[model samples]
Target: MKVAVFSDVQAVLPALEAVIEHIEAWHPDMVVMAGDLVNRGPDSGGCLALFDAMRREQGWLPVYGNHEVWVLRCGEEAPASEGERDIRRFTDLAWQQVADQAERLHGWPDHLCLHPPDADAWLHVTHGTMAGNRDGITPGRSDESLAGKLPQGVALFVSGHTHRAHQRRTQGMDVVNVGSVGSPFDGDVRGSYGRFTWRGGRWHTELVRFPYDRERAARDFETSGFLDQGGPLARIVYLEWERAELLIAGWRERYQDAVLRGEITLESSVERYLRTIT
Candidate 1:
C-alpha cells in the first residue's frame, strides 16, 4: 500500500498546489490530511475551495485539528462582545465559504483505521491528540512514551501537529509525523509532505519538500487584514516567512509559564496563542 500524508496547509494555496502536484505524480492509493486545514491564514475561503477540488479529483481522509474546531465554535450563534463579534464575523464568513468541504471528525481516532486487506497491522492517524490536550505524541517526545499512550492494535501511527517531520520504529511498529504542507515550525520554510509504502513485509517512508510562491501567500495576508492584527499571524506571514520555528518556540516559552503557574487554563492558553498567530 502507498499512502501520501500531509497536514497544516492553512490557507497557503501555493503550498497546497505543490502538494497536489506531488500527489498526482505519486498516485498513491490513499491520501491523509492530518489536520489544521483552515482558520489561521487570511485565505480560509480559498483553502476550502482547494480542498473541495482535491476531494473531487481524489478522495481525502481528513482529521480534525484544533483550528478546525476553533472555526466551528466561532461560527456558532452566540452573544458576543464588540471585539468578539468582529472576530466571529470574520470566522463566520470563512466557515460559510467552505463549510461543505471542511470534513469534520469527532476525534483523532475517527481519521484512521486498518486498511482492511492487511489485518496483520493497523494504521492510526491523528492531528496530534484530542482538543485541549498537549501531551499527545509529537516529534519532541520519546518513542517509548508515545507507544504507551497509543491504543492497542496500532502498528503504524501517523500524525501532524508539531509541524515536524520524523520517522521512528520501535518495538516492530512505525511512528511517523508527516510534517506540515504549509505552516511548518521547522527552520526550513519549504513546504513538506510524506509518502509511505508498505511492500513485501517492509515499510518505506519518504519526506518530500518543495518551494511555493511565498510572496503571493504573503500578499494575500496583506489583503486579508491579518497584517494589521499585530499578532502571531503577522509574524508568521510577513516577518518569519523563512521559518515558523522561532515563532513557535517563542509561543511555547511564553505559554509554558502561564500553564505551569495555573494562571490560565490550557484551553484558554491555546486559544490565546492561536488567536495571536492565526
Candidate 2:
C-alpha cells in the first residue's frame, strides 16, 4: 500500500493543486492532510472547499492542526473589550468569509493510525504530536526530547508544523516530519510532502518537493483579500512568503508584548520590522 501525507497547505490553491497532481501520478492507496490546511494565505475558503471536495470524492483524511484551532477561535470567541471588539470584528469578518463550513476543521481527529494488511505495526499520523499541535516535532531535537513528543509502542510517527521535512529514527521508532505544502518556514519555496509505502511488511518513506506557481500564490495574497482583511499580522505573513523564510518570529519576540500591552500598535510594529528588512 502507498500513502501520501500533506500538511500546512495554509490555503495556497496552486500549491495544493500541484500536490494533488503529484499524488495522482503516484496513485497512493491513502491520502492524508496533516493539517493547518486553512488560513494564513489567500483563499482560505477555496482551500477548505477544495480539501472538502477531495475528501468527499476521493477519501482523503484530515487531522487537526493548531491553525485550524486558531481560525475557529478567532471566529467563535466573543470580544472582551472595545479594542478587543474591534479586533474581534476584524477577525470575525475574515473568518466568516472562509468559515461557512468551519466545523469541518473542528471535526477532525488529532491523529490517525494506519494499519496495513498483515502488518503488526501501525503508522501514526498527526499535524503535530501526541503532545500537542504547537511547536511540533522537530527534525534535529535530541533523542530524549523527540521521544517525549511521541507515543510509545507505535512503529512510526508522522508529523508536520515545523515546515521543514525530515525523517529520523529514535527510541526504536521511525519519525517523519512531512513539512509544509504552503507557507514553509524553511528557505526553500517549493511545496513539500511525504510518501510512504508498505511493502515486505515494513514502511518506506520519502520527502518530495513539488514546484508550484509561487508567483501566483504571492499575488493572491493581495488580490484574494487575505492580507487586506487578515489584519496587521498579515503583513508579516506576506513577507514570509516573499522571502520564503521566517521573520515574524523575530518580530514577535520584539513586539508581541508591546502589542499586547497597547504600547505599540500592531501596524507600527509590523511596519517597523519591515523597514529593516526592506
Candidate 3:
C-alpha cells in the first residue's frame, strides 16, 4: 500500500493546491490529512474549498485538529455579538466551503484492519499520539514517550499536527509524522508531506518536501483581509514558514510560564497563543 499523509493547511489555498497536484501525480491509494484544515490564514473559505474539492476528487481521510474543532463549534450555542458575528461569519464560510466533503473522525482506531489484499499489513493513522490530543506528540519529544504509546501490532503509525516531518522506529512499529502540507512550521516554507510503502511485512516511510509559493500564500493572506488582524498573524506565518523551531521554542517558553503560574489552562493557553499568532 502507498499512502500520502499531510496536515495543517490553515487556509493557504495555493499551497493546498500544490499538494493536491502532487497527490494526484503520485496517485496514492489513500490520502490522509492529519488535521488543522482550516483557521489561521486569511482564506478560511479557500482552505475549506480546497479540502472539499479534494474529497470529491480523491476521497481522502481527514483527522480532526484543534483548529477544526474551534471552527466547527463557533457560534453553535452562544449568542453572536458583532465581533463574534464576524468571527462566526468567517468560520461559517470556512465550514460551508468544505461542507461538500468534510470527513470527521472521533479517534483513530488501534489498527486499520481492512486494506487491500496487496497491502502487507494494517495501516494506522492519527492526528497525533494515541494518548492525548494535539499537544501530546511533537518532534522534540523523547523517543521513549513515543514508544510507550505506539500500538504493538500495527506495522506503521502515521500522524501530524506538530507540523514537523519525522520518522522514528520503536519496538516493531514505524512511527512517522508526515508534517504539515499547507502551513508548514518545520523551519522551511516548503510544504512537507510523507509517502509510505508497505512491503514484505515491513513499512518504509519517507518524508518529502516540496517548494511552494510562500509569497503567493502570503499574498493570499493579505488579499483575504486577515492582514488587518495585526501584523503578528502574518509575521508568525512567515516566521513559521522560515523557522519552526524558533516559533515552537517561543511558544514553549510562554506556555511553561503560564502553566507554572496557573494563569491559564493548557487548552486556553493554546487557544490564546494561536489567536495571538494566527
Candidate 4:
C-alpha cells in the first residue's frame, strides 16, 4: 500500500495545488492531511474548501493543527486585553473566512492511526508530538527526548509543524516529518510532502519536494486582504514565506512582551523588527 501525507498548507493556494497534482499522479492508496490547513497566510477559506472537496470526493483523512485550534479559539473566546486583541487580529481575519464551517473544522481529529493489512504495527499521524499540536518533533531533538513524544506500539510515526522534513529510526520505530506544503521554514521555497510505501512487511518513506508558483502566492497576501487587514503579525507571516524561514518565534521572543505590556505599539514593533532583520 502507498500513502501520501502533507501538512501546513497555511492558505497558499498555488503551493497546495502543486502538491495535490503531484500526489494525485502518484495515486496513493490513501492520503492524509496532517494539519494546519489554514491560518497564518491568506486564503484560508480557499485552502479549506479544496481540501474539503478532496475529502468528500476521495478518501483523504484530515487532522487539525495548532493553527486550526487557534482559529477556533479566536471564535469562541474573546481576547483578554486590547493588546491581545490587536495581536490576534490575523486569526480573527481567518476566523471570519471559516466561521461558517466551524462544525467541520471542529470534527477533525488531532491525530490518526493506520493499520496496514497484515502488518503487526500501525502508523501514527499527528500534526505534532503526543505532548501537543504545537510541540513538534524535529531533527534536532534527541532520541531521549523523542521517547516521550513517540507513542508505544507504532511502527511508523508521521508529523509536520516545524516545516522542515526529516526521517529517523529509533527505539524500534520509524518517524517522518512531512514538512510544509505552503510555508516551509527550511530555506527551501518548494512545497514538500511525504510518500510512504508499505512492502515486505515494513514502511519505506520519502520526503518529496516540488516547486510551485510562489510569485502568485506572494500576490495573494495583498490581494486577499490578509496583509492589510491581518495586523502586524500578518507581516511577519508574509516574511516567513518570502524567506522560507521561521520569524514568528524570534519576533515573539523580542517583541511580544513589550507589545503585550503596551510598551510599544504593534505596528511600531513590527517595523522595528523588520528593520533589524533586513
Candidate 5:
C-alpha cells in the first residue's frame, strides 16, 4: 500500500497548490490530510475549497486538528476581555471563511487507523496524539516522553502539528511527524509531507520537502485581506510564515497577560515582539 500524509496547510494557497501537484504526480494509493488545513497565514477559504473539492472528487481522507476545533468553537465562545478578542480575530476571520463548511469539518475524524492488505503491520494517523490535537509530537522530546504519546499495537504512528518533520522509534512503534505544508517552524521554508510504502512486510517512510512560490505566498498575507482584517496578531502570523519559525508562543508568553490587563496595547506588544526577532 502506498499512502501519502500531510498536515498544517494553514491556508497558504501557493504552497498547498504546489504540494498538491506533486502529490498527484506521485500518485499515492491514498491521500490523507492529518489536519490544520485552514487558519493562520492567508487564503483560508481558498485552501478549504480546494481541499473540500479533493475530498469529494478524489476520495481524500481527513483528520480534524486543533485549528478546526478552534474555528468551530469561535461561534460558541465569547472573549472575557478585549485582549482576547484581539487575539481571536485571526480565528474569527478564518471562521468567516469556513463557516459554510462547518458541518463537513465537524464530521472529520480525529484519528485514522488503516490496515494494509495481507500485511501484519497496521498504521495510525492523527493531527497530534491521544492527549489531544494541540499536543504535538516533536524531535525535541525524549523517547521516553513520547512513549505515552503513541497508541499501542500500531506499527506506524503518523502525525503533524509541530510543523517540524521527523521520524523516530519509541515503544516499539515507528513514529513520523509529516511536517507543515504552509509554514514550517523548523527554519526550513520548504513544504513537507510524508510518503509511506508497505513493502517486504514492513512500512518505509520518507519526508519529502519541496519548494514553492514563497514570494507569492507572502504577497497573499496582504492580497487576501488577512493582514488587514485578521486583527493585531495577524502581522505576527505573517512573520512566522516569512521566518518559518514560531513567534506566537513567545509573543503570548511575554505579552498576553499585559495586553489583557491593559498594561500594554496589542499593537504596542506586537511592535515590541517584532523588535526581538530578526
Candidate 6:
C-alpha cells in the first residue's frame, strides 16, 4: 500500500493548491492531513473549503492540529477579562474569517491509524504526540524522547508540528515527520510531505520536497488580512514565509516570558521582537 501525508498547511491557498496536484499525481492508496489545515495565514476559510471538498471527492482523512484546536477555542464565547480579550482581539478577526467552518472542527478526529490490506504493519498518524499537539517531535531528538511519543505496535509513527521535516528510528519503529506544506521552519523553503510505501515487509519513507509560488504566498500575507488583522504577531508570520525560517520561536523565546508576566504588552513585545528580526 502507498500512503501520503500533509501537515501544517496553515491556510496558504496556493501552496495547498500545488500540494494537492502533486499528491493526486502520486496516486497513493490513502491521503491524510496531519493537521493545521487552517489558521496562521491568509485564506483559512478557502483552505478549509478545499480540504472538505477533497474529503468528499478524494477520501482524504483529516487529523486535527493544534492550530485547529486554537481556532476552535477562539470560536467559543468571548473571554470576559480585558487581558484575555486583548489577546484574542489581536487575531480574532483573522480567525473569524473562518468562523463558519469552526463548527466543523468539532467533528474532526484527534488521530488516525492506517492498515494496509492483510498486512501486519500499519501506520499511526497524529498532528502531534499523544501528550498533545503542543508537544513536538523533531529530527534531532534522542531515542528516549522519541520513544515516549510513539504508540505501541505500529510499524511507522508519523507526526508534523515542528514544520521541520525529519525522520528517526526508535525501538524498532520508524518515526517520520512529513514536514510543513504551507509554512516550513526548516531553512529549505519548499513545500514538504511524506511518502510511505509498503515494500519488503517494511514501510519505506521519503521526505518529498517541491518548490511552489513563494511570491504569491507572500502577497497573500499582504492582501489576505492575515498580516493586517492576524494580530501584532502576524508580521512575523509573514516574515517567516519570506525567510522560510522561524521568527515566532525567537520572538517567544525572548519576549513570551515578559508578556506572560505582564512586564510588557503583546503589542510592545511584537515591536521589540521585530526590531531584532527586521
lDDT of each: 0.67, 0.82, 0.66, 0.92, 0.90, 0.83
**Per-residue lDDT of model 3, residues 17-125, tens digit only:** 8888887888888887777777766676666766766766768777777777766665244524433343344455555545554443234332233344765566677
Using lDDT, rank the candidates from best to worst: 4, 5, 6, 2, 1, 3
Preferred candidate (lDDT higher): 1 or 6: 6
What is the TM-score of each predicted model, taking all chains together? 0.77, 0.93, 0.75, 0.97, 0.96, 0.94
TM-score of 1: 0.77
Candidate 5 local accuracy as lDDT? 0.90
State which candidate has the highest lDDT: 4
Q: What is the lDDT of residue 110 in candidate 2?
A: 89
lDDT, model 1, position 18: 82
lDDT of 4 by residue, 149-175 (tens): 788999999999999999999878999
| Tens digits of per-residue lDDT for model 5, 1-278 | 89999999998989889989999999999999999998997877888889989999999999999998888888668887888888899898988888776767868999999979897587999999988898998889888776576788999999999999999888888999999999999999999999999998899999999999998987888887899999889988988888889889999899999999989989999988889885
Top candidate, metric TM-score: 4
Superpose all Cα atoms of candidate 6 onto the true structure and report the RMSD in Å to 1 decimal: 1.7
Candidate 3: clashing pairs of residues = none
- Write the number of the candidate with greater lDDT, choosing between 2 and 6: 6
Q: Count the backbone clashes (under 3 Å) in each candidate.
A: 2, 0, 0, 0, 0, 0
Residue 58 of model 3 has an lDDT of 68
The reply for model 1, stretches above 4 Å from the true place, is 77-109, 116-119, 130-136, 229-233, 236-242, 246-278
- The worst-scoring run of ten residues by lDDT in candidate 3 lies at 105-114
Candidate 6's TM-score reads 0.94
